[model samples]
Target: MLTDLHKQLLNDFQRDFPLVERPYLEIANRLGVSEDEVLSALAELRDNRLISRVGPVIPPNQIGASMLVAMAVPEPELQRIADIVSRFPEVNHNYEREHRFNLWFVAVASTTDHLARVLDSIERETGYLTQRLPLVNDFFIDLGFRLDLSHA
Candidate 1:
């Protein structure tokens, strides 16, 4: 069960998260809670799988190279392959699709050469071929979600 604080933590910080040195303290002050409470609630949220991470969303390929990669993985091997891919720090997130190329992930690295090397390493480790799709155009996709907790 989520308390009001948990919902606020998720909803409020989706945008304009503090960039200050003591970010949790700032959040705690705004919420009228102690810094420890904010920290504890965040840990609880993560431990319960309500949230995956708290981090900045950089614009695609602005500071680094990124590619959308697909792999035609066998059904039985999907979980194993996904685990291997997720282990790479370069991979942001991966998901399944109902297509021949069933697994897809976005990989970001400091340089194009580094990105390619990471992809090559993934191919070598997973024993699967990767179809790299570089972005040709930019799109504005809103990635934030407001947790409507009125009924909760």
Candidate 2:
């Protein structure tokens, strides 16, 4: 069952916690709890896989460059290729998508050229060709949705 505290935390995230020096403290204050409690709750959520990470959602284009690279990973070499890709420091997130290009990953770089080079390195190491898709134009569409726990 989702506790009242968990529900409040989710609601707060959907509304944007705060933009301040001590954001956690602010959230704790609002929740009528101590800062330690707030921190502990967040940690518990992450440990239980309810929340991934509590951090700023930084836009790659604004700070640096990022590209979505997809690889046509053969079934036999899937694990080996994934291991090679994960070794690259530039690769932030990697996943297997339901498509011909099974292995999908994002490599954030200092620049567009750097991003390309990172992809090239992956191709060289994995011996798997990559299809690089850099965001030419970005449209930020907020997809934040509140989870329903009433049934629970």
Candidate 3:
């Protein structure tokens, strides 16, 4: 179940995230909670899949190259391939979709050549043809969400 603390975290930390060496410590201070408490709460939320991750959301093309990649894996090999793809450090978000190109993921690297190498490695390891869709323009990017735990 969602709690007020979780709501506050979801709302407050979505943007202007601390970039210091000890960010969680800074967050704990700001939230009037112990560092351990903040850490435990984040771990609980992640373990329950309430949030995909707790990390910086760098603007696209700001620091590194990123691409939306998809692969059509046979039903039997889906789990194995997904596991393989997820093992890469470059892969941030991966999910299964109800479409011909079922497995989709986002990969980011320091440069375009590095991004290509990651994709190539995934293709070689999984033997699946990956479709790379590089971003041409930024239409809309909303990484923040307000969760009302009061209703929960």
List per-prediction Cα lDDT, in the order shown.
0.92, 0.82, 0.88
- How does residue 25 of candidate 2 score in lDDT? 95
- The C-alpha local distance difference test score for the whole of candidate 2 amounts to 0.82
* True lDDT of residue 12, candidate 1: 86
Off by over 4 Å in 1: 73-92, 118-129, 141-143, 150-152
**lDDT by residue for model 2 (20-64), tens:** 999889998988999998888888878888877876666568888
Which segments of model 3 are wrong by more than 4 Å? 1-9, 16-56, 141-143
What TM-score does prediction 1 earn?
0.70
Index of the highest-TM-score prediction: 2
lDDT of 1: 0.92
Indicate the residue-level lDDT of 108 in model 2: 92
Better structure of 1 and 3 per lDDT: 1
Show pairs that collide, candidate 2.
Answer: none
lDDT of 3 by residue, 51-103 (tens): 77898766777898999999999989999999999999999999999999999
Q: Count clashing residue pairs per candidate.
A: 0, 0, 0
Give the worst 10-residue stretch by lDDT in candidate 1: 139-148
> Candidates ranked by TM-score, best first?
2, 1, 3
